[model samples]
Target: MKANETIIVEEQLSAPISVVWDAITNLNSMKKWFFNNIPSFKSEVGFKTQFNVKSEERNFLHLWEIIEVVPSKKIVYNWKYAEYSGNSLVYFELFENINNTTKIKLTCKITESFSDDIPEFKTESCRGGWNYFIKQNLKNYLENS
Candidate 1:
């Protein structure tokens, strides 16, 4: 984040680490909340996966290559769009509280061409979007299911 150019949004959800981890790692569970057209997905390291993300009128075709996976703890992947040439990294960290609840933290760092594009590739937008999806939608899906 450069000076006042980027926005950082952080959210904490109350759920067991196992449940949250499963929701993220399991392709079936992830599609329910995150992607509407996730034809294929995997959490295995070195695996390449493709998933579709649609929000209302806009559609996004996401291609990701799993870079790292630590069972029951963390997973990191490179996120890139088929239409876009640049790539970013998405990281998921799972922490366990004393009450058996999990504190899941999602950190996304933009490292490609988009980072240089000021108003177009707004960092605040990415932060807010990630916060909403992980804190609100993902929590609801994992807790209610």
Candidate 2:
């Protein structure tokens, strides 16, 4: 079981806090960069959604429930896999910067142990995934839009 690890990824987006906040909270904006198959999403607490992501010939049913929201400042959610053993809390925080930019800090803390047989559940793999989404995808999406 690999559930004691915590991964934190930070990025400075070339957009204001409002823009960054909308990108993370708005379902339409999320589809463009986060997950296109997400049927529904909301920033309000207690909202739950599930979607399947196929990778490496495996089906991962992602379960997410919003746990906290502070408008444009911070949002936290529970992230887990329906068929997996581990559960984690993901926090997205935004800080306004000069020149209409926003600095985002993403923290993923594992609250329960994950099965070790899955390669994607490794700490490094999870870290890489977060970096890819935040650094490559989200950064480019907000910068260009």
Best by TM-score: 2
Per-model C-alpha lDDT, please?
0.73, 0.93
Candidate 2 runs further than 4 Å off = none
**What global local distance difference test value does model 2 have?**
0.93
- Per-residue lDDT value at 51 in model 2: 97
Q: Candidates' TM-scores? A: 0.82, 0.97
Q: What TM value does model 1 have?
A: 0.82
Residues 49-106 of candidate 2 have per-residue lDDT tens digits of 9999999889999999999999999999999999878999999999999999999999
Estimate candidate 2's RMSD in Å: 0.9
lDDT tens digits by residue: candidate 1, 1-145:
3323323334455667888888888888887888756777778998887866665654457888889999888899887777644567788888888777777778777666554443334666677778778878888887788
